[model samples]
Target chain A: MSTEANRLPTATLPGGHLDCTGCTHRTDDWKTGPTATFLGLLLFIVYSTAAAFQGEHYMYENYLSPMYSPVVFTQLERTVTTPEGETLKVAIPGAAPVEHAWFGLKPDAWPEWLPFSPAFLILAFPGAFRFTCYYYRKAYYRSFWANPIGCAVGPFRRGLYRGETHLLLFQNLHRYALYFAIVFIGILYYDAYMGFFRHGEFGVGLGSIVLLLNATFLACYTFGCHSFRHLVGGRLNWFSKSPLAHALWKRASFLNERHMFFAWLSLFWVGFTDFFVRATSMGWIPDISTWG
Target chain B: MAERTFEIWRGDRSGGEFKEYTEEVDEGMVVLDMLHRIQARQANDLSIRWNCKAGKCGSCSMEINGMPRLACMTRMNQLPAEGKIKVQPMKTFPLIKDLVTDVSWNYRQNERIRPFKPPAPDSDGKYRFQQADADRVQEFRKCIECFLCQNTCHVLRDHRKQEHFVGPRFMIRVASLEMHPLDTDDRIPDLKNEFGSGWCNITRCCTEVCPESINITDNGIIPMKERVVDRYYDPVARILRAITGGGKKLPTA
Candidate 1:
């Protein structure tokens, strides 16, 4: 096949760098898609970083942020009152003391030699999970990388591209990261279980509701993962013979369709859950408790 | 008589605009039927391509209302009748004429993939495959080469990473050959280094636009990706490969 013969008869023009000189495929709505994605990711980064560093308010009487689950570093417990006027002490099991600085049961969750936010320790697991996620790869690639910015629009640069074969090889670690993400979901549900206990009695609070919603939304996003879909349903030749697998696959497919929606919703909602816990712990907001 | 308005693209690669045309359309008529009417009645020189008037032939792929789809497969009733139905060439490929694109780029890519290499024959001089194994490859065999998946893919459409990505169509093409039970060649190196399997990112946009409903991303691309990860990235697999002189080899039939 002759390359020249296969070429279209349209007038050719010189391609350029930076300016996208001589490109004719520009459209008016091109900026909207990349702009939205850019702002969304930027907002997430800023808010998540601020909340991660503000170490004082991650845990209140019963509620815990998904960001700081598994209770890796804690000093001790303290007594506090809910907005509903019930007094309860924060006595979470496996909750320990910090050796260094800031808030918690004891003063030193951080050592003199080590100065770091507790959120920093665990945020990377979920952070890496999202950063290496297939959906987020597309999100950041378009929004941050400006790789063409949008369809038919000129890209920022043109060059020899070896896609994900070299420096970006860590993207292949997504399936491995997914295992950690699944384990984190278990950790979060455990936090939700702890939310039901205030002074060893069963009760519901506004924080409890928020934690449950965060867990549910994040679970939806995690379960809807393309990797999860492949593991659960893919590789099988027969859905007919495997009825249980087929049923689970159908449910996964249903969630997969809404993965993008859940991704953004859970992203913002999880951040809000963190903020809610922080504000209430900081005494900026009041938590309404319920006897269930 | 109700007249359906269409803003059909009217030019070639150099420049183009959505030129408006109003035509009488009946219920159950498709966009391709309207295009055929426009060709016969209004613009005799207008260039468009179609075959099988049905959806099976992936030839008549173009953007209708900003989505890559088969012109024949899209029903006239499905689209909002209140506005101008926009018909344009696929943005990813270079435009040849009105509603026609030069999709030879996909053909060039298809040529790069290593074709199926069957295992050595037994005493009977024949290769045998289990029904289950055949069924696995059959899912991918349903691809009609429509290029809708290729056109809709953001890596190709938005990023123009043609140098790095082969789009979703060829991923499954390589997959169909790789997953064949009777095949005995390793294309994993090509998929890793040359074929751009690492670039796919698995958005499933290709699966969404597939008229054949092949799960191009989940079933085909992800499995191929895991294989690439296993061979190249897995630490345990790498150590085992070194000790065992590069893992398991397919048996001669």
Candidate 2:
């Protein structure tokens, strides 16, 4: 052992430095992963921003974009020519009267202080939930923040990391945000219910299916939450005593294993739901109904 | 007679190269068995560290086929028979010899965590804790100190942020101590500062490589993070605690 110790090199390699120049240990898939994440998030941001601003195209018949669901307020009025060629002017509560027939819920005018889209008002809840999601925290931290960019990869920020300690202390609100997300799931499901009713009679349309899928995907993402698993049965000593919570936790754990998949799936499908409503509402696509 | 080829690292700290050896391996034999055979039949100076061959001691941690795992637990049948399996010392730590990395850094880290100390005994002159409360920390105690989580942790492995970040093994250590029901020492400040619980990004890589299947990230790190947040970040909680002198109290058992 003494001889072996003597044979060992005396020089030790220095670590924990702030420099990341030309590090050799970065993963092979490093560039591709961040590039995809950057592009994907960027696409969602640009599309969602534009769709939020283009408020006229967010609703078709009873179908609504999950983004602008439970319309708190609207500043929209339009002139519509029905299939029978009768023109009518309809105005939502917040906007000036114009020659159009408006559909769906019309609430009191949005306070003049908040100027953007109605979608902007409600999206923050889900966005905060995703921003602080355990899986999404890794995704954005690696891809967007470039903090040690990938698993064993060279990172942009090299030195001491605070890691949601101080500046991102609000991230601790994730469990609280789960409450909002759960409530939104119910709201969106309500919209899905509204989607199936055109003129108070039961009807199924392509837009209804889109809204249904948006609710399903969002439910998967929300139910698969790590905090939900903890809230259900994480600290329990015996699973046998509380079988219902244990079973729910087992199901949540099963879903938590695929949390990443559901996260991406919900993100994409929510975006698609917005696009579908926008396109059909603007006459870019026909609202093909089963009965009609 | 199935002959499996092994590409083993064979040198010291300065440099090394993969030296190939073809060994006749048996069914139900693990990679450690082949290494023992090579040490006995071919090279006597082949150095490797192991104690309990049943995967409990955690002294046998090495990278097999570029994955950090215990050699004794890895069955030969699980490996692809066609390619040469490489056994290298864990890249996270300094190497001393062939297949033996100097893991003394881990022991030093283990020392940083404050051990459990039960408060002064009750009126009966004995410490008491409910089985339910003890069971809360029992899951984290399953760690065998294999340091696989330490070796696999990205903050330590890739960034080499050892000075700032305590790896996953010691996170479990800190979690075990902090969750003890009868223990009444607060380690949250140290966890935030010296132990570097904040540096963990909750990637679950450590939990994935854990041989004990301990939920190191979800159960240990995240909960500790919540405690840190409750103490340091939540202004209302902090102010209320300042007024009430209550912070992260275990229910009286």
**Model 2: what is its DockQ?**
0.20
Model 2: per-residue Cα lDDT over A22-95, one tens digit each: 24322133478767988998899898888777666677678778887757655566455789999987653322
- Predicted structure with the largest TM-score when compared to the true one: 2
Q: Assess the local accuracy of residue B167 in candidate 1 as a C-alpha lDDT between 0 and 100.
A: 85
* RMSD in Å for model 2: 6.9
lDDT against the true structure, each candidate = 0.73, 0.74
lDDT of 1 at A252: 76
Backbone clashes in each candidate structure, one number apiece? 13, 6
In the range A60-80, model 1's lDDT, one tens digit per residue, is: 777877777755556445456
Q: Give candidate 1's error at residue B72 in angstroms.
A: 1.9
Give iRMSD, candidate 2: 7.9
User: Which 10-residue window in model 1 chain B sums to the lowest lDDT?
Assistant: B244-253
